[model samples]
Target: MGDHALALGTAWAGSVQAAGFIALPRRELTAALVERAGVLLDAASGTGDPAAAGAVGRWLVEAHFTHPSTLEHTLTVLGPALVRAGPDRGPAVLAALARGYAAALQERTRAEQERITAAAFVARTAAEQARWASEARFGALFADAAIGIAIVTAAGEIVEVNRALCEMFGRPADEVLHRSVDVYIPADDHEHRQTLRAMQAGELEHARLERPYAHAGGETIWTDIVLSLVRAPDGAPRFIVAMIADVTERHRLETSLRHQAEHDPLTGLPNRTLFFERLEAALEAGRHVGVCYLDVDDLKAVNDTLGHDVGDHVLQTLARRLAAEVGPGIGSGARAGAGGSGHLVARMAGDEFVVLVERPADRPDPAEPLRVAQRALDVVRRPVVSGPHRIVVSASVGVVEREDSASGSGELEKAADLMKAADTTLHWAKKDGRNRVARFDAERHRAAVARFELSARMPDALEAGEFVLDYQPLVRLTDQRLVGVEALVRWDPPGGDRIGPDVFIPLAEESGLIVPLGRWVLSEACRQGVRWREEHPDTQLFVSVNLAARQVREPGIVDVVASVLAESGWPAHALQLELTESDLMGTTGEPLDALPALAAMGVRIAIDDFGTGYSNLAYLRTLPVHALKLAGQFVTRPFATGMPDASGEDGHDGVDLEVLALLIELAHTLGLSVTAEVVETAVQLERLRKLGCDTGQGWYFAPPVPPAAVPALFSGPVGPT
Candidate 1:
């Protein structure tokens, strides 16, 4: 058993060495492993169990023999040793050993994958630390590494060169030593020299750059050069150490990967990623930049008509023609000049492309962008030939230009903003008619930006409690008595004044935020109404909350409303739910159907902004509504021509009075009361009362006030005078 173990361990060590596991001496490693193998052989032969074999595998791994070949070689050597030592049980023992080693190897593979993932996560910071910590090993690595190495004085004169460095440059040591390191750098590569200068001046501690070096045979050798500055014991600068790795094949692979990543596979045009990179560079260069965003017209229609194959062909052909007309080696009318000014054409997305032009800072030309836009339009409108098919394709272009400033400040417009404006302008061009160009308008962009900001902040605002409700009094138009208060939701964003409902309400409704938002308002209004009712038992005031169309359409709206009423302990009759005319107009939907069930529970329903919608008065009769809230426009339009006299009786002319009277009569005939909104002036108030409006609300009584001020408004018999 002892001789068999010794033989097996010696063979295993040799196999590991062959597999590149030579960290320790062969004799020492074999002697230690033999002792461990003796224990494994006893267990495998006696018990026929693989536990000892697993232990041996772990021991091998701990000694850094974890390569795939190490396991293969271990089994190959140990199997034969077992067979020779104990022929009767050799095959069984060998099988157990193989299973144990394979199991442990699987664990090692998983551990190694995890280690690689962790290493990649912190590679940059870890690399810097490792480079600095290995200073003592640097001498040995520099001398023994297969790659090239050189030590140069701070003045850029080479002081020493290793054999590998000489072989890499194809030159003798005598010919390379004492020469300026800059001789190897290409003439056009001034950036490389600047890096060296920075290193010498201590502006940088270490740097790596892939650059071409002049070889002895008049050929160029691409190398990844890692240069680090060495300092004296007292911290003064000493010399520069450079490690050169020949990365010709690596460079080719990298270039191919970059091309694949940055170009459209089908069209072979630069993609959105590359376009933004060029745009950023142009912005950084402080040059006047312009972009002409283009979209192929009716591409989807073409795809649907003539299968996608021909559609793809059309795009490819168009791309080729566009590139041929306005790219390198072709007579592209638009070109770039010094100061990093240039033109780049890229595919923004499916059927959309953009041509970016940069004008030299010294020559700021306003007409350049217009000329490029016209040229691009002309190029795309030409007919394209995809195989046997001749497809006529046209495109719309949106052009945007920026003025060059000495500061190159991007505070006003950034790359992302610029791209968005171009997109909006492109949409404008498409709307006007395809096959044309449109320029960005500042006012239009501002409106779009404001809408976007309002929509984007809605969800966060709701979650962060940026929303609150203020109450506006609804009064009986005849007696000027406060009947109820309408709960108006308002957004008071952080560090900003209150944003009115007009700005963010429609925004919330459009973005589907009204469902959750409406529920919150319902709960809050009910809570406050219950408090007010409890405080002033004599007052029969109720809370009127407006519901958005989306809120009405919600399948769970009935449950949500019931939950709020139950939670707040507020009477259902004291809560008036207002829905827009359009919301209740969906005569056959769940919302209209749900109204009767809610009204039966003592929840009064009213059609708000009544006459502003296209819904007929006949449809109003079908709704389970108790009141009609005439839109503010009907009341305000009467006074628009001129206000009434001091008596407030002569505000409305013939048509205004007739319209208001007829609507009220119709509402009364349908068994519904009428409410008038926007009664700001006494003339408006007296006029609404004469028109038989049941209740009125406006700034005349009180603007929407916070919840804390509700007590004061209801403290008296009537609201604010």
Candidate 2:
């Protein structure tokens, strides 16, 4: 096509001779395969890797074979390029292209073979039956079968046999013919003898056994045998017909299936079905079974928020955890029952699980069950999450012994009842606080039933003596000075112990009574703070209370806070609203706009659990933030180990410690001071001091005791080292 075309072709021919092997793929195919072949060739020509330019050429050649039409088109385009290219470059380019095409053709064959095997095996029911029938007849047609075949007498005796049978028994056929079949059987036959006798007496239609048979050599060979009773015209027994097939492989598979079905698929622990079966047997023998019911609190929330796939990961982690606790018989002298093992755990359903323990039957006291329950409770309380969600879900266990089950009805029912009760107790644990485990208490059922009914009567209970507040002091770590008090919501039952916010707060949230309940706390805490300030004006006490995430976004939140300030005549700067990371994350942009308005009014916005949210720095910086309270977890290790918060290349100071430091610095740079929470030791204090931490709070300053203890804490020693 061009004046240099003849010269380019001549140069390319020399390269083919110089390089012993080279491939030529079509131009159109190469163009189709390579997103930018020209750019790839141009860039790779400068690379030191000799394979790079050749590899790309091979990739294009493979595409040509895959799409055959592209091959002709690609070659036509390539000819023009080769004709125009200067002599030296054209030869190298053509040589590389030659080898590439051949490699592609070989790869295509491998991909095809793999596809044939991957296609699903297809067979009709009749076809499968025919194949099995044909397979079964393979050995049956052997005329002179070396193994013995037999027909037993009417009385379950071996009455007839073949020449092979006589040889096997080391006796003449007549001498061995009438021998009793049971003579060669094992002593502890269990029910095998009955099954064989049933077949001989026309009771069992077919009975099979691979039982040991004694030979003339005084050795035993386990035989594969099937028994079938033969009948005369009037239904009288003639003799038993038998067929035998050696099945050592099939027997092994059956045993393996039994093992798998009994154990958990994930943890290899006994499943609920198998556990109950074992417990039933143990109970029948008057065994004292200690049962612990466990539920991983956040498995579902992890599944729902992150994904079910990740939730499965959490379950696996939990299984490993439970295994480590009370595993390997690590505690050599643990309490034991009549049964052999100490503990058995089972995953009953999603996130719900159970643990069964064997307690010493000799003990008059039932403290051993409690000890097991305590151990189980401790194991589950540890924080375990699949991926991003670090949730601590504790379990509640109801441990009841099978004291008097008639020793025959089975432990399964009793153990199951205990499991149900333990599950019931766990509901109360959730009521108490999600991370606390509760042991089953039968004596408290009446009170619990009342509480259950109270769910219906909560609105009325709110009007009654249900909710109140006791203030806890928020003190300055620098000096033993009272800066503010956090008002904790409490619910006092008519004439009993006050229910914690843990129990009733969820109830309030569920019933949508939090709006009223929260409103009441705001007004009450404001009124109380204003009253305390008036009673002791020199004190200048401020009130801080938890504001639910739902309240943060509500249009009425601003008005309520405003009304509280106006009615109580307390300064907004004195009151601080502590909202959790989730609360801030859940808010929309406009609802979040309320933050600026509140900050403008002098109500300080503190992001509680500062390091534990999904907020990016861009959004965090745009916030009307007055203070950033570090979560206890992020700085707790540094606090414990006396380590300065510094960065290293290998990345694990504390999850994102560097990022947090930057966040703190960013807040500082934006004219905001930061507070590090859970600063419990002097080392942590020193670390925080070095980090330029502005405020510190934890038990190190003062524990949250009674409201009356506040004034004493202010005057008394802060804490003992």
Candidate 3:
């Protein structure tokens, strides 16, 4: 192989002058050709593989030995030398080398043909004889090329088309030639026309675009087209040459993939990605927009009871109905002169679906969203039959509408804010009642947002000691003596404003923060009680703290209470826990069982707000209850004026003195002490005292005071105002 490479390398060097445009020096070029010859010889003798020979052929093309005579000259000089070195394998090697050279030469020739076609426009400006010669040279490539080609005059008239172009359009050559380009390309295509105008005006040398063309067989063919402007030697625009490749199948695959990405598979509706895209586009356009967010109520129950198959069927059916009802407007309104703007119904994961409606900025309809929501609920309520079972479902809808004028700049709202508002309204609909439509209410939404913010800040507020206790006196009705104080917690933020328990207690309970917050309140109240006892040793004023229902149900509540009592050194007997009548009545199982243990620890259990709940007086006797604090209504109702009684008598109070008298008597019989709440006037205090109310607390005696103020009240018996 070494001796054969040297002889072949010498022959290759001899052919370099005829090969034309040799890029390398004589020594380097000789060495590269000798190495390639060695590889070919080795493969032919040992492995019998032709791939090595093919690689060498491609190397020659890359090394710029591109003249038509290069391959012929190479074979003529080296063929006999190779045959002499390896006679048995020499013929096979020669065949492989010829095939590789032809393949590479063909590819390079195709690329060069395209370049010469582009150069034809400039060449046509030469002498008439030279133009004819250039055309003759391009004619062979134009006739045999696989890609479609067309030559159009500057006025967009097709002067000629190659056989490939005619075949691409499924037409004969004469039928397509001499026709206006508009016969194939649509005149109404603005982008294509603009590109052509730019090229014809000498502003652009070339442009590439993908467009659809109509075939002779009445099918659309997607084509990747390259348009090159042929200009005169003076740079004046001449004819245009277009090279086109059919991309129909590739375009179809791309379209299918994009559809799968943007649409729900089961329902075939637009997914959240496409929905938000259209929403943001609408908002950016400054259109008045409406959104209806719908959630299928109890769809999970269908999946759990029947099967996921049925659940899928239900979702698909609902999606179809919503799209059919709402999408007709979408297509027509998307056009310029349509009556409406547009609408899009999309599936937003699981049982959630969202509908976006766009309206023109000149006309805004706030009630349109509500109507759409109602229509959605109506359609969803229709029964759907899947397999052998029929399923009925309802949807809760939240509707939001923003007027373009509201923003003063034609932009109605942001997409994110609109969606969030719609979601919040949907929650409101579900919360108010299922199968209902809830329109966005700014006031109610603001209050809910404020509650959420306050709830989120509660843990930090509690950690910072922002919570404080205010004592409301629980007085004795008989002697008008200050007997106890109900401990009420207040939120005093750094801003120096106090928030009452009514505003934040429910928030704490909903967020599960009440467990820790209640524990803190209990510990603080117990500590305050110990301080009061030390300040006034003679007075045995019990401190009453209201318990939230959530706190009562806590697993370690009894332990928490015991720990607080033991830590504060406050007597359990003097620390009263008040539970709302409803909370105590609802208590059962462990929560109810825990009550006795608390009572055993000497803590008094009183039912606060008595008669407000549907209480079984007989059931109250079974519990370890200490006292009943009559609901404020019972005290205020007897003296109430300007109200009708249950019997509808005008100016007669709802409850007279008799009802109050009977309530106090019933408490005595149950072995329960009674406390009359909200004692305001001297007359009411006298009436309660006459009714044998054991204790009372009202402004008539003294309003709730701080711990320091309580000692002053303890200095004397309190009298009615």
Candidate 4:
């Protein structure tokens, strides 16, 4: 067994040496492996645990035998020897050894990947450490290492060249020793010459860079070169010492990794990262640029009906078509200058691509984006044939152009804004109808930006008391007596013009700020109602506040309303919650279920803008509704000026009047009161009263006024003229 182990160990050592980069001596490595193999042979003979053979695998790795073929060689030598030693347990021992080797290799591979990830930042530190270690062992270790070294005088002539350096250039010592150091460097490498001059002049202690050197064999060899200044005993610059390690393989790997990082693997197109890099560079150079952002419509449907493989094929086909049709220089035009004058077609993400056109400052073509967008659309509309399936798809593109004169805070910010504008325009294209191109509209973008600003500031505005409510009185149509006041929210931003609900309400609703804003409105209105009732104990006035769809659907909406009423000392019956007819009719589940619970608490629920929605009388009968606010369209249509009477005289259509009358009668029949909205003229008011409308609220009563102005209207009937 001892002889067999020694023989196997000798073979293992030879195999590892052939694999290259061995850190241990042949004799020492062979002795260690022989002892490990003896233990493995014992394990196979059942004198020791078979798993103990795993340690031999670990020992091989620790000794720096990490070549890919090292394990194969170790296994070949050990497998047969162990089985011959003890046929029964040999297979188990071999399996244990293989698992250990694989685990160690996997761990080492993961660690190497991590090291590569941080290679760029750590390269200088590694070079510095290598220099220090080499200097500490300058005499023997310096000459023996695979690293190339050269000692040069302050005059830039090589005084001595190590044997390793000569071997590195594929030349002998005598030929390289007397040559100037510049002879080994590229002639056009002015930066390296300047750095070496700085070191010789005592301006710098050391410098590190990775550069390529010419080999005698007509090949380029990349090296991590560290140049250090050697000072004399008097502290004057004496000689320069240069140390270089062969990094050709590492450089190749880094270049490949960079390509992988900046490109979409499947499409082989530049990715979002590289696109933004080029876009920012163009903007920084004050170049005129345009971007066409595209999105594949119905991609999800394709992914669902056909497999993801087909979906991927579709994307790949689109990428190839876009690259072919809308590649660099497509829209640069004749005036494009050398600087920033080209185009880049990149895949931004799944089913999305962007084509960037860059032109010199002298050339500004606003229409370039539209042309590129049209071309992109044309290409995407072409049918893609994947195996067994013919897929036809369209893309919506948003186009944005930035002229050289455009002002922005910074290049990165400008690039981001351009992308945002492109994305927004793409949405417009999709919304307008897919398969079309939409150019960025400045006016529309400004409005959208303003809306976004408003939504973003809403929560803070509410918290800061920047929002206030104004009361619009709802009065009886017959006597013009004050019945109730609807609370309308207004944004009274600090040091800014008061903004009406028409502008910010939808913004609030879209952002979900309506829930909290609605809560604030309800609480404030209830408190104001309680105060007004205290001042006039005989009046039975109610306060109506509109509820947004989001608020109505809130899980704890009933609790929120009940808590507000309890905190305000206001009567629930005197508080009417109004919801638009469209919103009320579409509600289901929790929202619909909450209405009855609210009514049970003596809170009145009214459907506002009643005539505008489905107006399903049957559906209306099922809800716990107390009142209906007739939409202004129905009430004002008959009395509206210049409206021709088709079926009647006096500029009023008989059909319009009949519709208004029927709405009022139906509300009464359903045990609900009716309120007419937008009654601006005396004629409209008289007609509403004659039609038996229970109440009316509009500019005719009063525009929405502050809390103090509301009490004056309560003092008099203010009957219609």
Candidate 5:
């Protein structure tokens, strides 16, 4: 019994410390607890005494183990301690001990309650005197409260009002007290009346909202109002308590901030963000949406000539004028023009603005956008006085309309795409002539997109080796002997048919991809030239590669040519570099210097598309010596005769043989060979030979063939040279 008591005391001390009961000395508390528990356990085990359990409970309460959990721990720990003390103790005895402990705890609770009731009885006698004073204090506080307070009866009549509520409503206490609550709310405010009815009917226990309150001064005061229900002891509804806090300043600030965010600061017009928001809203409502994308024509010139200050003034003035003419506030009462009240004019960005117009719901007119655009154009053409300068400006407008619900993208993206299409059409209007309105055309836009797609794919196509070269024979005009072949590039894109140079070459030049593409052509042509030279050693055929103007101006032209010749082991004399007439006519610097240097290295240079670009004969004579390939338009002019004579003694064909004769003679005088292009028939070939044309290239000789077909052409028969 002594050992079990000591162990139980130690365990109890540890558990109490763990439970944060650390006010007393641990050793004293543990020793006293163990002695008490041993005595209690002995009585309970020997006689099964309920008094022993009651004593244990009282001891627990005195030790300040008043927490239910602490009491539970005490009882739990005592169970084992009792078992240790009496080896024969059973569950029945433990149950009796639990019942006794619970009775003791209940009795302690009843005693505490009795003591509270006695204290309350004494307080009640004193509270009667304090109650009158507390009521007076409450009345004073209510009168002096910062927030407005009002008490209203269940019948919707104001029962009482504090000083703040009287001041808040600008009315005397007696005048406001008897009035209905409806005086504070407008009769047209059905929604507010419905809310009030719901609260009064017990449908709502409490309600809070920000609403405008009517002031006796004939102005509305915004307030954050809260209504709370008061109930009697039986839970029956009593008078309602209403509290109101003035929020007029906050509401004004919020409105001002929203205006600033949505409007352009300089022009006081809606900005792009708000314009897109309105567009999305209209689309969501499934309204027919139309927009006029307007651009200030030559506005950059105005900015450059005057200054940015003047430019800003011009934009602001223009914005005001456009708004007056095309916006909903135009003219007078009826919203002016066909736009009605469903229109928005916004400044998109620098030098660009847009006017959004929606068809009226009663009568939808598809042509209303055009009328809006015309009005905007008329307004833009008016002169604006900025500072001392009276600047006259014109604008171009592109209009597009959408009648279907938005698809393919979300609301914002669809609006963005619509604006983009409008901008594109606006560009077209500017291109045709500034200060005009243009409607979006599906075919033109589709063609433009196709061009963009082809241009986008050029670099990848080059990387994938989809580009290749085909050779067309440049034959001798006299005997039709194969003298040279012009190398033309073509794109054989994967999963698509062959794309011609006419399509992708110009695209390449525009995108500046021509530099590498031209390099590939030059290198590949030289490489193939070496193979042809080995096969046709006696023929002495040269390979020609046409060069774009940009490629000729590239910094490393001479080096590239030298590298290609060195790499291919092809003689430089057998490679001809063909340049367009404009390339050689007006050019200087790199091309002029590079051409002579290349000629000095024994590489021949020829002018392709001669008689085009109106080359200066005097200037042409100064370029390094070369052959002139006459443009195909000259020789292919509908030959009149079935056969043409080799001699020019008789003017046989309708072709201007006189001009051809003079051009050939001019070339010979300059010590240059002349090549005729498009010499298709025997008559044209005979006429070119008679005119002293040295070589000819046309479909009549052969269309451009693959490199594998070139060797076969070399073995074929040749006419007399």
Candidate 6:
């Protein structure tokens, strides 16, 4: 624990002292040299000597502190011997020797500290070395560092710069040292020191931005610089270290790459991804934004008529037109407000265009966004001459405006909502003959989505045993006696209330739920038909069931129908399949191949919704249709005047009278019986009967009731509702 024990600074001094001794010469030492060297060195200090000492004493004096142990021992022993020789010479020799050893110790201490610094520098990683924390030892460490690094003060002064920093700056580190960081910074960035100072002051601990710094030839080189604050443990500013890299090439490539990702090569506008990003950020930023989703309705016709090259030209023209309507993102402030501070335009996909506005003004009477949406619609509505084709492609737009806090991202919902609204409105636009803009309505969207959800769940409900057949008696048109019953599938989901097929059947077909549910209906209908036949042998008639498009399209539809018949032990003709126009649209994919197969199994196919689907009698021959059930639209409502017109065509002008005539005449021509749906009023029933309608199935006959109620219904008289 005394002076000989290891101390922080002295341990380093001791290590250096050892280093200095390793180089001491061990050449042939004559007794004369040792004695003479000792005498000369001793005499040089103060004592007179009889002879010279060896070179060891001189070596120790020259390279002071060299051979400290040896120096100490020799000085002690030799001084004593010299004292015996003479007091004057001995005392002075010892004093001179002590000074030489002390100087050597100081040199060894300096070397050890340098060695420690070099090792620390080498141990640092590449990233750390670039801007290592500044220390007084940095001067030595800087020279020893493998990568370039620099240190700057808050006032932008480059103090104690490193060699790597110099190499990065392409100048000598010393020359670069003490220069204002502004010397390397461009003039435009001179006022931007607040950023760096803030970082140094611990406001921002780190920052990375590429800026051009002047090099040796005044060559402005782009550098990717990471600046971080070197702070004391108490969090006060020590220095700012700029770990810079020459990223000129990397920057060039990255910029080139960013353009490729964010911009379209053809139109050079923001792609879908970038457009949505801006829309989402705008939404998140809580601004009033608007979006005009537009699609060129005529683009398909344009491509068909004028080749894709000219079609592309029209699209390019359309892009330019949109650009004129709404300014392209430009300038910093302007780019920040690119979509008009609240609006953005993007090609959602295909010929469809989406003009997005983030700032959807929440004013109940807001008109600016509406005006912009109208303008965008009008801008693209104009005719464009693409080469030889004068393509008159009008735009259909669905505009949606919502404020930032609109519940969700609003992009997906808004885009979909707008597209649907625009499509529905655009249909009127088309019927009114093209070129229009429409804003979205929440209620309409909600209604449609509700309907869609209802439809999509039906088939699954049926599979889960939620569907039951409700039988409505089909009475004899002449006698008012119940001949058979029509089976309607009803949904009564467990843990919920019951819903009629009217609520979900159409939906099931649209969402492809009808494929499975339709099979259920047919199978159950036939089973019920057989039960009725057993219950009332006198009422040995048929049961009619409705088929959806998805069911008709099912690959096993015919097999399912035949299986139902076999399982029910009911004749195929006793179970009638009532198919609407939507059903025929799907089944026609294979030329009525399924119809013929079902017909061979004695299953009768009746075309439901006949006149409404615009039936071309020429193609009806291809179907194995046993009967035609006129569409309810043509057989009901105010149009059902139920009177024959001058043409003797059963009042051939309205829903019931006129359409029924066309239906009956067409059915008679095809040797098929006609069943009028919804024959409610006596006038309509009598009209259909006169039109030679062979059978009637409607509320005019009986209302659908429970199976238990059916027995009571047929037990008595059954007639029009």
Clashing pairs in 3: none
- Sorted by lDDT (best first), the order is 4, 3, 1, 5, 6, 2
Question: How good is model 3 by TM-score?
Answer: 0.74
On residues 1-721, what C-alpha lDDT tens digit does candidate 2 reach at each position? 2233343334433433343433444343223333334433343244223344457557654433323334434444443454244222433453455345434543443343223212211122542321222333433432244445676777878865666556655768777667887765677986778887676667766666666566678865445665656565456665675544333323332344355456666566767778888777766666666666666665566667778777777677767767666432225564333235457767776677676666445643455556656676677777765556686655555555554223445423466665655667778777776655576566464456555676666788778757778766665546536677777888777887877887777767766778888888888888777766665656765677788876886877888899889988878998888887677666443327577788888998888887777556566667777777778876675334554445522223554455556766877887777777776777666556556667666777765554555555444435553
- Candidate 6 residues 1-721, lDDT tens each? 2221122223333434444453433332222234444454346445444323323334454544334354444443344344444433444344444444344443443454345334433333444433434455666665655344677776678886666667777787678778887666666784456677577667987776667777888777776566666654455676676655555543443454355456554566666777767766665665565666677777887778778888788778877777655654222454435445434566556687666655433423246556766777777777888656576767766665663213564533453443455555444444455577665665655676677677666656666898888887776666566666778878888888888767776677567777777777777777777777788777667788887666777778787877878888889878788887556756344454577788887877888878777466776876788888776766675344656568775443444455557767877898887776777777776666666777776776678887777776666557743
lDDT of 5 by residue, 1-721 (tens): 5776677777877776666665679888788777766666666468546456556655555556655456556656665566555534422344444445444544564454344223322222332431223455556656776567787777789987788778887888998887899877878888778878877776767777778877889888887776766554445565576777665644543454356557776798998879999888876676777889999999999989998999999999889888877886333463734455546899998989999886556666787788889889999898999778899999999998774223433322378778878888898999999899999776687677799899999999999999999999988765566778899999999899999887988899999999999989999998898887777776678989888988888879889899989998988888889888777644642236678888999999898888887466775677885888888877865364544357644335444667778889999999999988876676777777777889888877888899998877676544333
User: How much lDDT does each candidate structure score?
Assistant: 0.75, 0.60, 0.79, 0.79, 0.75, 0.62
Q: Any runs in candidate 1 off by more than 4 Å, and if so which?
A: 1-258, 280-287, 295-314, 317-342, 374-398, 402-408, 412-464, 493-496, 586-597, 641-651, 712-721
lDDT of 3 by residue, 533-650 (tens): 8887898889899888888877788999999999999999988899986777564422266789999999999999998875677777678888999999888878776444577653
Instruction: Locate the minimum summed-lDDT window of 10 residues in model 4.
Output: 115-124
- Estimated TM-score per prediction? 0.58, 0.38, 0.74, 0.70, 0.74, 0.63
| Candidate 1 overall lDDT versus native | 0.75
- Distance (Å) between predicted and true CA of 618, model 2? 26
Angstrom error of the Cα, residue 565, model 3: value is 2.1
lDDT of 1 by residue, 1-721 (tens): 5787787777777776787756788778788777766866775567445466656656666666655566556666665566555544544455445445445544554454334223322222422432333444545555566567788888889997777788888999899889998887767888998999898887888887878777888877778676768765445566787777665533443454466557776798998888999888877887778888999999998899888999888888778867766542123343434343356788878899898877667877677677777777888788877777778888899988764222445423578878877898898899999899998777777787789888998999899999998998888876777789999898999999989888888888888988889999999999999888888888888899988888887878788888899999999998899988778866454337678888988899998898877557666767788998889888887776555567854655668768888999999999998888888887777767777778888888788889888777655545434
Q: What does candidate 4's lDDT look like per residue over 49-96, in tens digits?
A: 878877766666677765546655666677667767765577667766
The residue pairs found clashing in candidate 5 are none
TM-score of 4: 0.70
* Model 5: residues with Cα > 4 Å off, grouped in runs: 1-144, 160-175, 214-220, 329-342, 403-413, 534-539, 553-571, 585-603, 638-655, 716-721
